[model samples]
Target: MKVRTEMYNMFDGAKDYLPVGQTTLPKLYLILFLIYSGFLALWAYICNQQRKNVDKIHLVMGVLLLLLTLKIICALEDKRYIRNTGTPHGWDVAFYIFSFFKGVTLFTVIILIGTGWSFLKPYLQEREKVVLMFVIPLQVLENIASVIIGETGPATKGWFRWNEIFLIIDVICCCTVIFPIAWSIRSLAEASKTDGKVAKNVEKLTIFKQFYIVVIVYLYFTRVVVSIIGAKVNYRYEWVAVAAAEGANLVFYSFIFLNFQPVDKNPYLVLHELEEDSAASAHMWEENISLG
Candidate 1:
């Protein structure tokens, strides 16, 4: 009886030193995200195996999904630690690194969808490529700044100022790619005639436009709404919302992958190849049956 009472007193004392917050919701969302990511990875593997030629887009998307899954896991684990100890140590840096890569992969996915590789190469410029290359590096710098600020003052609370700055930069970068892609699709849809091939192209672009719009909305929810709420309320709750948002985003990407597998069958790729083949055949026939 004496030992049990002493142990209980010690446990009570330990609780007084622990951080305060509920972890159940964050944990639940993390589990869901993990399961979703696992399924997506399996689907991507199957997609690659079924294809006559391996699809780079699908492979890349799969890898990105896995990376994002790792990011979420690291983030939640870090949060869990913070909740228990009132401070983050190692997992904090791991979370930031995964976050950096996830952002880069997301940008790559957007580029792949906006411009089918061979046909749309002419539309993209060297400068745009350079800009894309810099996004991850800039994000890395931002993370470093955030960490330095966070550790120097009230730990995570010190990041409030940097968070807002980073949010603005993120919005700008997302807009640069998203708005132009939306505009280009709209232009294509308007220019397309009501013929079979052209109509098919328009249909595909319409779907792409819808997907892009949803993505923009999701971005707004994550970057704007969550940021605002986190600033006003507890950051832990904000993480719960973020986990849910990320899970939904994963679903969106999965839908995109399922609907647009094999890349070659995509209407844009099909039409472009058809036109190129027709032109080649026409030139060959003219050469063979020349009329002088």
Candidate 2:
């Protein structure tokens, strides 16, 4: 049996166009670019029509989608360069740059959403801020390892070290993302008993549980299942593994946007703030307490 690929002419003075095991990348990336663009546009429309309901968290989601779209375009261009010249000399830098920002923004959105920030409340806990502080630096190192791994191939002495570092950091980040979700579920369960909003808390608990499950499934598929597939597959079928990973990503991002997109809500339920007169009275009480 023979698999036909787009091989360059022998007289063209190039060894190969697309790299081995990556023949499908251009088409895959192009399609993803279009799909991501559609998501970005749809999210933008939803936000525009519901302008009064928009919040900082909605802006973060939009940024995540925009980053993903730009990242895919960079990937497409890089693949095109690879297709024509057998190298990603110039375009891979852009891809990695977007890749870094995308990773950071993605984790920010994930952690914030997991804790119900700007949806259930307007503030983050100190511990949550600590998570963000660490994640940004970790993302930087992850992308650095990725670029090094890609540029050095498997031949360099430190290639194995970088690969291990990349995997460890990735697994850490994946694990980190789920804890906040778990915390939210537990908090909702406990709050239902104490907050005098049992029904509301129960509804949110169900949503949080569903979100936790989605995150676990998404991470397992992308990290564990995809790795197994790539490891077991023939080198020639690497494209299949890549496609599976990207497809999972597309689905994951789409689900996040759909599940959590902004909509009009009762201000009291969403913000947890007192009515204006009550708020003013509370402020006076606080001031009197402080003065006493």
Candidate 3:
């Protein structure tokens, strides 16, 4: 029962109720908020430079970054409030509200990325839409369960129940996400056959495969590795687990944004204006030649 409880290590003979494995979270979240704020600014500049080329997906990523930054701010304040008062209250509610929305928005962005929606294509296939319909609802449920778990704390039976529900929904969403990435890769491979753009399609396929690998790594590290760390660390050093999970999250977000940035040459995205111009020019040349 001791190990099962969320233990708060003593500091100078006084119990700290800020939650074990998360005492450093306030500082961590502060740092994360600053980092994401900077990232959001840089992202805005990049999008501005390529305004004509950016799409809904590109803008969605910016929104995700903003949500993350704001959520980090709220979380830091809430944790500080808890550390001082021995309980979650006011700001805690705001934190969870932002957290829930951020999670759902993140899931939507990831789903869109895996399906190549708004980046590589303007439309979604029926199966891809179905994936969205199912996974988005599951993500919503997972977020709800996470909030309940957070409010109840890990020591309570209610927390245990909600945590289980959270895990089940999270696992389902993870499994569901993989399908779209795999489908995109398969579609690219098939397109390479008859599209007469073998080289380009192959490049796209390689990018998709790499994205898939990164997604798997991100999920594994954040979910499994972080849990393992929390369980294995000494009681006093529980903050390490929080740091590990947050660090992984920061890296994962940075990678996704950079990899799929709205640029003319980002192989992860579809070619638009420049390619269309080239094809149009080629067609005009052929027409002129035939007339002459």
Instruction: Go through the candidates in order and give each one's C-alpha lDDT.
Output: 0.61, 0.81, 0.79
lDDT of 1 by residue, 93-159 (tens): 7877887787778877776666543233444556446656666566666566555654454455656
Which parts of model 2 are misplaced by more than 4 Å? Answer: 1-16, 265-292
The model with the greater TM-score, 1 or 3, is: 3
Name the candidate that leads on TM-score: 2
| Poorest stretch of ten by lDDT in candidate 1 | 1-10
Sliding window of 10 residues with minimal summed lDDT for model 3: 1-10
lDDT of 2 by residue, 23-54 (tens): 67888889898888888899999999989888
Listed in order, each prediction's TM-score against the native is 0.69, 0.85, 0.84
TM-score of 1: 0.69
Off by over 4 Å in 1: 1-19, 83-89, 118-127, 145-161, 194-196, 231-240, 263-292
Candidate 3: give its CA RMSD in angstroms.
Answer: 5.5
Model 3 stretches astray by more than 4 angstroms? 1-21, 153-158, 267-292
Q: Which residue pairs clash in candidate 3?
A: 21-238
Tell me how far the alpha carbon of residue 223 in candidate 1 is from the true structure, in angstroms, after superposition. Answer: 1.6
Clashing pairs in 1: none
Best-to-worst TM-score order: 2, 3, 1
State the displacement of the C-alpha of residue 128, model 2, in Å, after optimal TM-score superposition. 0.7
